[model samples]
Target: MGRSPCCEKDGLKKGPWMPEEDQKLLAYIEQHGHGCWRSLPAKAGLQRCRKSCCLRDRQVKNSLAS
Candidate 1:
């Protein structure tokens, strides 16, 4: 059988995140810490998946390196 989707794709945001999204994610993480990626989107009020959040975090970290 095919792998199940990590999260519902409907209405979920894809591609690069906006500045406000970055702020929301960062703020949520700061306030609650990284509890669970799977649940973080709903908690953070973002329309992304756990993997997307992780990638966004990684992207932020990489950007900071330069």
Candidate 2:
């Protein structure tokens, strides 16, 4: 059988991120630079999986640079 989807496994959150979640991620990334997307959510106290974090990082990275 095919492996289960990562988002569906382990009860990891899936869907739009909350404002507080974004703020938490932004602050974490700003302070720690998101060294590894795969390991970032736990470090940042997020319920989302790494892919969600990765996408959010992409969205904010450019703005953060400005």
Candidate 3:
């Protein structure tokens, strides 16, 4: 079976995330934990896909590890 789309393509933000966007995502996950990737973006008020959030989270972790 084909994979389901991570998010709706229309009107969604693409490319690098702004610092504010990263902050919002980080704050939301800190408060609520990583409940659900698919829904977290909407809950966090981000116009990004769940995959983007996951990737961003990983990037943040990697940066901190360095």
Candidate 4:
């Protein structure tokens, strides 16, 4: 079976996120316990997919570890 694409790649920006973006995402998740990832971009005001956010964090952590 094929997997569904995560977020809408319309006008959303994708790349290495800035500190402000990271702060906003962290604050949003802290305030709102991560409900629907599909709708998270709108709610959290982020241009990234929920999966991308998670992957970014993991990548950062892994890089730091090594």
In Å, residue 19's CA in model 1 sits off its true spot by 0.4
Tens-place lDDT digits, model 2, residues 1-66: 998766885768888878899999989988998699888999999999888888888887777788
Q: Is candidate 1 or candidate 2 better by TM-score?
A: 1
Assess every candidate by TM-score.
Answer: 0.83, 0.79, 0.86, 0.66
Candidate 1 accuracy as lDDT: 0.88
Question: Would you list the clashing residue pairs of candidate 2?
Answer: none
Stretches > 4 Å off in candidate 1: 4-8
Query: Model 2 segments beyond 4 Å from truth?
Result: 62-66
Q: Pick out the ten consecutive residues of candidate 1 with the lowest summed lDDT.
A: 6-15
**lDDT values of the candidates?**
0.88, 0.86, 0.91, 0.74
Query: What is candidate 4's lDDT per residue for 15-52, written digit by digit as tens?
Result: 77888877777677779876777676678888888788
Q: Distance from true position, residue 52, model 1, in Å?
A: 0.3
lDDT leaderboard ranking: 3, 1, 2, 4
Candidate maximizing TM-score: 3
Candidate 2 at residue 13, lDDT? 85
Tell me the spans in candidate 4 whose CA falls farther than 4 Å from its real position.
1-8, 57-66
Write model 1 residue lDDT over 1-66, tens digit each, in one string: 998776567889877689999999999998999889999999999999999998888888799898
Winner on lDDT (3 vs 4): 3
Ranking by TM-score: 3, 1, 2, 4
Tens-place lDDT per residue, model 3, 1-66, is: 998676568888988889999899999999999999999999999999999999999999799899
